[model samples]
Target: MRLEQALRSGRHLSTADPTEAELLIVNTCGFIDASKDESISVIRDLDSSRRKGQQLYVVGCLTEIAEAEVRATIPNVDATFGAEQWDAVAASVGPASANFDIPQPEFTNIKQPSAYLKISDGCDRPCTFCIIPTIKGAMHSDTVSRLIAEAKAHARDGTRELVLVAQDSTAYGEDQGDREGLATLLEQLSEAVPDLPWIRLMYAYPGRVTRLLAETMARLPNVVPYLDMPLQHASPSVLRRMKRPTVNKSRESINHIRKAIPDVVLRSTFIVGFPGETDSEFEELLTFIEEQRFDHIGAFTYSAQKGTPAATLLEQVPEAVKIERYGRLMELAQSISHDQNREMIGQEMKVLVESAEPTTSADGSPVVIGRTYRDAPEVDGLAFVKGEFKPGSMVDVRVEGALPYDLLCSPLDFHKP
Candidate 1:
C-alpha cells in the first residue's frame, strides 16, 4: 500500500528492490501460523540466492519467536533480530559495530500521515488466543522522555500523525515505573509534542481500558477520535475459557465515549469459532457487534498459534465452522459499514492525499487517489479523487460516494492555501 501510493508520486520508499539493491530485509509477523507461513515464503525466495552478492536480514516477531528454527533453516541470514534488535541491525549494517544508534527508525514507515512509533515491546495481557506474549515477550516500555523526544522528532520530520503501537498499548509502563501506563504516557506525549496533528492508539485491551483513558483522549486535541479497542469476543463463557480476564464492558465504554465525544470512532476486532465456543456464545458475539455498530470492525477465525493457552484447549472448532462464522461476522460488518459510509457521503472531510496512480479513467481522464484521517493507509480505505493532489498535502473534500473500504470524493481544492 505504501509503495503503490508513495512511489506513484515520485516518493522514495525503502522496501524490496531488484536483486541488485545494496540492502534487503524480510519483515515478518510471527504471531500466528498464517503470518509465519507468509514470512517463510518470502525468506525462501531469497534463501537460494546465496551466490548472488546481497546483504539480507530478517527482523520482527519471528526473529525472537522461532529464532532457533529460523537460524537452522535460513543460515544465510546476515542478521536476525526482533523489536529489541534494532540497534544490533543498525550496527551490522553500518560502521558502528556496536551500540549503533540513529535518530530515525531504519525500517520504512508504510503508512501516510500517521507513522507507527513502536513505543513499547511485548504483551502483558494473558489473552489465551494470542501468541504475542510468547513471541514478543512481556511488556517493556520505552521511557516517557524518549517517547516524547521521538514524537517531537517525528513532528519536525514532517510526520503529521503518530501511531502509538505495542502488543498491549495500554500496558506500556507497567513493567517500568510508577508514572507509567499507556493512558498517562499518552497525556505526556501529547503535551511533549503538541504540534503533531494526530496521535492514534492501537492494540488496546478491553479490560485495561480505564475511564481515565477516555478522558485523556477526549482532553487531548491531537489524539485522534479513533481507537482500536480490540474486544476479541463478547461472550463471557468464551472469554473465560479463552483466559481473557476482561469483563465485557462494551456498553459502558461505548456509552462513556459517546457521552464525552459523540463523534469518536471505535474500531474493534473479534475472533469467531474459538475453542469450546458454542451457538449461544456465537449469538452473543453477533449481538455485541449489532449493539456496537462500530465505525471499524475486524474479525478473524480461530487460528492456532503455538504456545498460546487456547491452542491446547479442548473442543477445537472445525475449519468449516470457523469459516462460516467468519463469513457471517464479515457480512454483518459490511452492512453496517455501508450505512456508515452512506452517512458520510455528503460531509466535507479532511483527507491526507496519499499518492497518484497512473491509470486511465472510464472516459480516459487521469485520476489520483488518497485517504482521509479516518481511513488508515492500507487496511482501511481510500479517497479516489480525480484532481491534482500532492502526496502528504492535507486537503478537504466532499464525500461523493462510499464502498465497504474505499470512499469516492471530489476535492475542495480551494480549501487549501
Candidate 2:
C-alpha cells in the first residue's frame, strides 16, 4: 500500500496488470521457505512473460535478506531494493509522462471497511528461530501524534475498523523511552477517531501485554478486546532454546490481560515443530492450547531460515515429523475454534460487512460476508449473515449457528451498544 501511494504521489500510471506497465515491480517476502518459494516463482513467471523492454525490479523483505541470492539466482532482475525503499522505487521508475496523449488518471483509493494502520516497523527481540529482526532491523515506533493523524485519516476515509499492526505491537514506544506508550497511543487514537467503530490490535508479543494496556483496551469503546499474541511454543525447554520468555511469565501476562478485559477474545499463534522438539514437548504445546482455549489459533510448522541461529541448532525435526505435528496442532485448534464459535451462537455482536455473496441460505435469504470484533481481517474467521448489507456498513447480528471456523448470523435490530 505504501508502494502504491508512492507511485501515485509521483503521478505514475498505476495498472492492475503487469503486462500493461513499463516497469514491473515485484515485492517479495523471504520470511520462510514457503514464502520465499512463492516470491521466486512469481518473479520467475513475471520475468518470463513480461515484454522485452519491461524492467523487473525486486524489493522488500526478500531483497533485504538475500539481494545477492536473488540477483545471482535470477540473472534477469534489473534492480533490487530493500524493504521501506518505496521512494527509491518510485524515483527509479522516473517521473510520470507529462502532456501525454492520454492524461494520467486521478488516484483512486479503494474503499475498505477495515484498514490496517501500521504503528511501527521492524523487530528487536532475539528469537532464535526467527529472521524478522535480521531482515528489517531494530524496532522503531511512530509518534503518537503521527499515529493519531493517520487514524483520523482512516476514519475520514470510511474505515469502520482500524487495526493496529506492528512487528511487536506491545513494544510500541520502548524506542522512545515511553513505558506505557501503546496505552497512551490507544487513548489518543480513541479520542481522535470517535466515529471509528472498531480498533483492533495484532501481533503483540508475549510477556509484554502490560496491565495498563489491557485496562486502556477495556476502557475504550472503539478498541475491541481482541489480542493476537504469538507464543511460538509452550514448552519451557523449547522456549529457552528459542530465547523467548518463560512459560510462567507468558501465562502471567495472559492472566493479567484476561482479568482486565473479561470479555476479551484471545487469538494466538504457535509453532508446532521446533529443533529437538520431543513428543512430550509437542504434547505440552497441545496442553497449553487446550488450557488457554483461545478464540482463534494459528499454527505453523517450523522453517529453518538461513542466517537464523535455529537453522544451525542440533536435532532439527525431520520434515515428516514436522508435517505430522503441524496437522495434529491444527486439528486440536480446529476443534477448539469450533467450540469457541459455538459459544457465540446466541450472542448479539456487531459485524463489519465486507461483501455480499451470490449464494443464499436454505430459506433463500441473501448472504453477506462479514467479520465480528472477535475476528481480524484475512487471518481469522468470518460471519456469514443472512441479509443484504452495504459493503462498508456495520450491522448488529445474532449468531444463529456455528461452523468450524465461521458463524451463521442474522440481522438484529440496532440497539446502539
Candidate 3:
C-alpha cells in the first residue's frame, strides 16, 4: 500500500493489467514454503507474459528473506527491494516529482466500507515455529497521535469499519516504554473517530491480553467484542518446544478475556502436527478446542520453514501425518463452530453489507452477503440475508438459520445510516 501511494505520488499510473503497465511490481510472501512457492509461481507466470521494455520488480517478505535465491532462480527480475523500501523502489523506477517527498498515509480502504489500519510492525516474540520476527525484525509501534490522524483519515474516506492489524498487536508500545499502549491507543481512536461505527482488532499475542485492554474493549461501544488470538498449540510440551507460553497461561488469559467481555466472539488459530508431536499432545489440543468452543477456529498444518529452529528439530512429523492431524482438528472445530452458530439462531446482529446478488437457494430470492461483528472481512464467515439491500449499508439482521461457519440471516431493520 505504501508502495502504491509512493508510485502514485511519483506520477506513475496504476493499471490492473500487467501488459499495460511499464513496471510490474509483485509483492511476494515468504512466510512458509507454500507461500514461497506461490510467490515464485506468480513471478514466473508474469515473467513469461512480459512485453518488451517492461520491468519486473519483486518486493516484500520474500525479497527481504531470500533475495539471492529469487535472483538466482528468476534472473529476469529488474530489481528487488525489501519491505518498507518504497522510497528506494520509487527512486529506481523513476525520478520523483516535487510532491513525491511529502508524507501521505496510504488509505487502502478508501471508498470501501472497511479499512485495515496497521497500528504497528514486526514482532518481538521468539516463537520457534514462526519466521515473522526474523523477516520483519523487532516490534515498532506507530505513535498514538499518528494513528489517530490515520484513523480520522480512514473515517473521512467513508470507512465505516476500521480493523486494527499488526504483527503483534498486543506488543504495540513496548519499545516506547508503554505497557498499556494498545489500550490507550484504542481509547484515543474511539474518541478520535467517534462517528466510525466499528473498530476491530487482530493478531493479539497470548498472555498479553491485559486487564486494561479487556476493560477498554468492553467499555467502548464501537469496539467489537471479537478477538483473534492465534494460539498455535495447547500442549505444554509442544508450547515449550515452540518457545510459547504454557497452556496454563493461555487458559488464564482466555478466562480473563471471556470474563471481561461475556458476549465476545472468540476466534483463534492453531498449528497441528508440529515436529515430534506425540499422539497424546495432539489429543490434548483437540480436548482444548472442544473445551474452549471458540466461535471461529483457523487451523493450519505445521509447515517447517528453512532456517527456523523447528525445521531442523528431530522427529519431524511425516507429511501424511500432518495432513491427517489437520483434517481431524478442522473436523472438531467445525462441529464446535456449528454448535456455536446454532446458539446464535434468532439473535440480532448488525452486518456491514459487502455484496448483494441473486441467490440460488430453493427460494428464488436475492441475497445480501455481509459480515457481522463476529466475522472479520476476509478470513472469517459471512451473513447471507435475503433482501435487495444496498452494498455498504449497515443493516440489522436476525439470525434465522445457522451454518458451520456462516449465518443465514433475515433483514429486520435498516436502522444504521
- Model 1's TM-score against the true structure: 0.85
Candidate 3 lDDT tens digits, 30-149: 987778999999999999899989899999999998999999999999999998889899888784444544444454434678888889999889899888888888889988887887
Clashing pairs in 3: none
CA lDDT, every prediction? 0.74, 0.87, 0.86
Where model 1 places Cα greater than 4 Å from the true spot, the runs are 1-20, 46-51, 67-79, 91-112, 176-180, 356-360, 413-417
User: What's the true lDDT of residue 352 in model 1?
Assistant: 72
State the displacement of the C-alpha of residue 65, model 3, in Å, after optimal TM-score superposition.
Answer: 1.7
lDDT of 1 by residue, 117-226 (tens): 77787776778888777777778888888778667766766777788887778777778764337778888988888877778888777656677777888899888888
- lDDT (Cα, 0-100) at 297 in candidate 2: 89
What overall lDDT, based on C-alpha atoms, would model 1 receive against the true structure?
Answer: 0.74
Model 1 lowest lDDT segment of ten: 1-10
